[model samples]
Target: MDGDAWRPDLTSPVGFVESDSEGDLEPSDLESDVESVGTSVISGPPADVLEADPAIIVAVGDSAISAVAATDLDVPVVPVGDVPGLSAVDPDHVSNALESAFSGDGRVRAHPVLVVETPGGGRERAVFDVTLVTAEPAQISEYGLSRRDESIAQFRADGVVAATPAGSHGYAEAIDGPLVSAAVEAIVVVPIAPFVTRTCRWVLPNDGVVLSVERDEDPVVLCVDDRTVERIPAGEQVSIAADGALSTVVVPESADGRD
Candidate 1:
């Protein structure tokens, strides 16, 4: 096992996508990502998972590609190849990364995945770095929330975000969400394109934080990860919490490669 990759249960690949070429990622340009396990299971795109059981995903593409792929598949990915946001990863060392990851060799970092329930009585979960809730009308909208049953925030804006620490560095940070230590058990909540200048982002503990789009007649969408096609209609209270830990990859200290 390599010294740099963390280890988690790898009994089955919830989903795995690979690209033979480099540069930018286009899932349609690559071969099918799904693998055939047996007569009971078959391989396909992320939308195929609605009929399949939930499983961990290994996305073999750049960060942007991997993020969308993983989000669609509804699982976390062991990013392979050239991923942008996942800096310092050696494309050549991917094999070593797999070995260390499956063998349980590197440091363990846990990321909380978000669980969303719809007003239509449908439930879906996302292990994305960030989940964005925006207005369906494509205009400014009203936002509401409560933490542990206590009213904390309510405002009008384009949308709001609930991101895991792993996501804090990306969209969360771009929206001015504070980047907290990934090691900490916390969730960052930020108002997206808020109407009020005083609106701010909050780094709350990952326990009982609930956020919702308070509009019912006017619809909104919950964009998981970044799969616009997989958007969920957000007219109901969507519960956000630490449903489970997403196993994050790290280039082991022992493996000689990029950071």
Candidate 2:
């Protein structure tokens, strides 16, 4: 399946009648009638977006490289994460990845980071590369913005995820978002458990898209790289922009079959 594939057909519909708890869940008695669902593997972004410039891409923690791009010195090592976005499968692979990045021409791939401003006058940031804006129970969520007085897409769903190409392989992919190529120059916005049957995921241009969320109910949470979590209180709003860049380490061409 393509990375951007949407499956609203597998989602349950919203009912008009309100219930006490969480309200209006699909009737449990209709479970058997809904039919069992199947799964499909979504591929990553298209090949054309991958720019091969024979550059050395290093995988470093955000703390080490967040303020500036590390292009002056050689990156000796990289810490790997078990999570798909930052995971480096094995020791040999890690070594090869570093070697490939080091031996290649001196250049790096850049992935955008999110700059989040909270209602409390506080701010947070993320690189390497997605920020999940969602609510619990996977249902009570809606996100939208009226830019320059024009209302953009008002996404109503259980959750909304905005991920960059480098981070697309992680939570974004797990939530059925497209696996954007790390080299792609776009951001993927996917709705988790959408109520609308024909809801479409957005592959927005990365010219600094801002997502604003506001409501009168409970606060919606923001998770940055699954590490930092913030809540935007009722009536207040939080804005997320595709800002900054995260440089990554690349796997070498010579280590093709080591896995």
Candidate 3:
């Protein structure tokens, strides 16, 4: 990941709402604050936001930020609520964060997005990770990993996860995966529960990596970020690569200082 100083025009800001009932903050209250700062607020769905093409996007919560990341839009995102991976200001400080961003006091960090291609010609983007796992619980399946036409390893496990640096801190870290720096362009690959006592986890290059379901007694599914996209049968291949990046705003005081 790379970062540059970015100061967005706050004259027109878009508010992307996922859920307003989480904390004490409400959508109406946020709109009033935006107006108080002499900025126009446009609130709608992701598609509407894309169409509106506002100067900056204000994500209200974790899911809103995830939704903005999933859109793959090349816009600067200022997270206002509790968002993971990147630093976010509290609900009470939304107006201050926007003011700082408008005054060139924020840095724009580019977070890599994972592009997952299925065998059926379908493609999806994930800001965090892509997972392949058995459809049923505690079911072991055979999976093969490779990169640039070279074989890496084959193992039996409940599932396998390929996570980006931003995602490496979440589920991947819980499974003892390495914490990759945001400055490094790498993918953290880890097996969920390997049959062998000691299995290997890899931090591979971000491109040209392929995962195939070698053998499966049960059905398997492919997940992009949070939701299951489709079922992947045996003998099919799934390719992942770092296609583009998401621009996220990191305010001065809200910086978590974590890679």
Candidate 4:
């Protein structure tokens, strides 16, 4: 979809039809990104999805290891806005995205954990400091649900989650989340301190836009794998687009370059 990958077949009588239809169906139209929960990856994802190319993308203000993990796996990650050939379906801008991100060459700050207290006779109070790696709450308007404003207005807004199978396990156990298999292609939407209980912790549909974290509090604590990386804050608001996308590269035993 990034490059000029198609052309009219000059020899076929039905040449123009496929080309004409393709111009209408672009990569930009993809809004939903699904999650596959686990520590070990599936040999091959199911036949349903049109797999995304393994990318090296940096979430601005994300942890340093965010980039580190991508690099170690030899995935060519740039920041969310860095890749030049990105589809319009991608909300983050790609134009100035690269240079702006490269400036953050070092320092991949980690997320913090908060100790929230339920204020007596008041809404729960969560005190946190914003750093580079954590989540916050945002409005529903940001996700193109404005047309359904009547329905959305009833709900309070929220943030994104970087859930792994291990993390999902903890969240589910702590917040009454559904017991989704670590091997399943799933991520839970356990709404943090939600206004309504019914709308909480939905096993997200495969084709969903898991809403981005908000920037309400100056900082929010991200619950990373059972440990607290204190004083982390929320950055750009974006959906929980878990890159469940994996590849089957041969894992060579350690020594040197043996490919």
Which structure among the candidates has the greatest TM-score? 3
Worst 10 residues of 2 by lDDT: 40-49
| Ranking 1 against 3 by lDDT, winner | 3
Off by over 4 Å in 2: 1-89, 95-107, 128-135, 145-150, 251-259
lDDT of 3 by residue, 1-259 (tens): 4467778666566555554445555556667666766776676776687677777877766566667777887888776655556676777777678778777888888888889999999989887888999999899999999999999999999989999898888788888888887789999999989889999999999999899999979898998887789999999989999999878788865657365
**Order of all candidates by lDDT, from best down to worst?**
3, 1, 2, 4
Candidate 2: clashing pairs of residues? 57-249, 58-249, 59-249, 138-158
lDDT over C-alpha atoms for residue 132 of model 3: 92
Error of 4 at 253 (Å): 20
Native-referenced Cα lDDT, model 3: 0.80
Clashing pairs in 1: 4-252, 4-253, 5-106, 62-83, 63-83, 88-259
Please list the Cα RMSD from the true structure of every candidate, rounded to 1 decimal place: 6.8, 18.8, 2.0, 19.9
* Candidate 2 lDDT score relative to the true structure: 0.45
Top candidate on lDDT is: 3
Q: What lDDT does candidate 4 reach at residue 41?
A: 13
| CA deviation > 4 Å runs, candidate 3 | 19-24, 80-82, 255-257
Better of 1 and 3 by TM-score: 3
Two-way TM-score contest, 1 vs 2, winner? 1
Question: Considering lDDT, which of the candidate structures 3 and 4 is the better prediction for this target?
Answer: 3
lDDT of 1: 0.54
| Residue-by-residue lDDT tens digits, candidate 2, 180-258 | 6655667777776777778877777654454555452444776655455676554555555665554433343222111
Q: What are the per-model numbers of colliding residue pairs?
A: 6, 4, 0, 19
